[model samples]
Target: MNKEALIALGLTLEQADKVIEGYGTTIPKSRFDEVNTSKKQLETDLASRDKQLEELKKVDAAGLQTKITELQQENAEAKTNYENDLKASQLSSAIKLALVGKVHDSDIATSLIDTALIELDTEGKVTKGLDEQLKTLQESKPFLFVPEKKEQKFKGWDPAGSNLDKDLPQDIGFNFAKEANSKGAPAEKALNPWGQ
Candidate 1:
């Protein structure tokens, strides 16, 4: 009999082997205990990490929403400012254009009225006190006069058949088909699909 059998029979291996003849059932249980403990610890860690991830996602979503709202408000304000500036610039240009030949002192009030009309036509009546005062002066102006024409200086002209023409070869008409076939035969079949 084996020593394990002897121990199972409540005797020392030597003593039980002398009295019995079978082996003992002696499988170790410690490995299973350790595995169970490790598994429980891993499960707990995974649950904690999952919870933290969910919370972080919530915070990110809230931050993105706030950013979106802020950007939209900024966009609206920029559009409003752009429109206001555009109107002011157009009104100023129109007034300057309408004041071209008018006298400074005679009918200053009438000139001012014409200036206001030009501004109204161009910028749709969004006016300030300064704009009103300018319009008043423009309307009060008296004599209407023609603006003088401006003189321009002429640059030298190009000569016929220069090397500059060589740089622009396409401007020189080269009839390759006429050279090939003489009497203006219908343009030879295009050399390539795009007729290069």
Candidate 2:
């Protein structure tokens, strides 16, 4: 309280001054010190923010916008290039899968196919002339493709125990002369292979 306000409460001039001097001493000094410290910190932060704002005002707005636009364009171009590369990679994988077990040389077959005519769908499938181009390449260059294997047939004689007993007579005699003749030998030579 001020000295005049304390005097208005019926204290004398000396008593009012003493009361004013002892008024705030009852409360801790550290509390006011803390509040003053916080106030100073707030002022310092406000001044720092004001200085930063002044620095920001000095920046070139038009130049910053142009740079931002250029960066955005570069980012868009990079994204487009990445998408194109991804589509091309997917198309190459599709082509390789389609050529598996069909082409003699996969690299040569891939080179022969018209990749420009091919397009990848959203599902990453060949959506255009890839199949037709591969077919045309196969027809134009037959040597590049592995020939379709012909189904093989077994033509050799059957096993001895299989159906032979039913076909032949039970008393079919063993004729040495016929056997030897069939083997391109005389009967005597066939019987004595040692030439004894």
Could you tell me every candidate's TM-score relative to the true structure? 0.30, 0.64
Off by over 4 Å in 2: 1-26, 160-196
User: What is residue 176's positional error in candidate 2, in angstroms?
Assistant: 33
> Model 1 residue 9 lDDT?
64
Model 1 global lDDT (CA atoms, 0 to 1): 0.57
Model 1 residue 193 CA deviation (Å) reads 77
TM-score, candidate 1, is: 0.30
Itemize residue pairs with steric clashes in candidate 2: none
Model 1 residue 172 CA deviation in Å: 57
Predicted structure 2: lDDT:
0.77
Query: Cα deviation of 12 in candidate 1 (Å)?
Result: 66
lDDT of 1 by residue, 27-116 (tens): 457977888899999999999999999988778777789999999999999999999888766665555544445434334433344433
lDDT of 1 at 41: 97
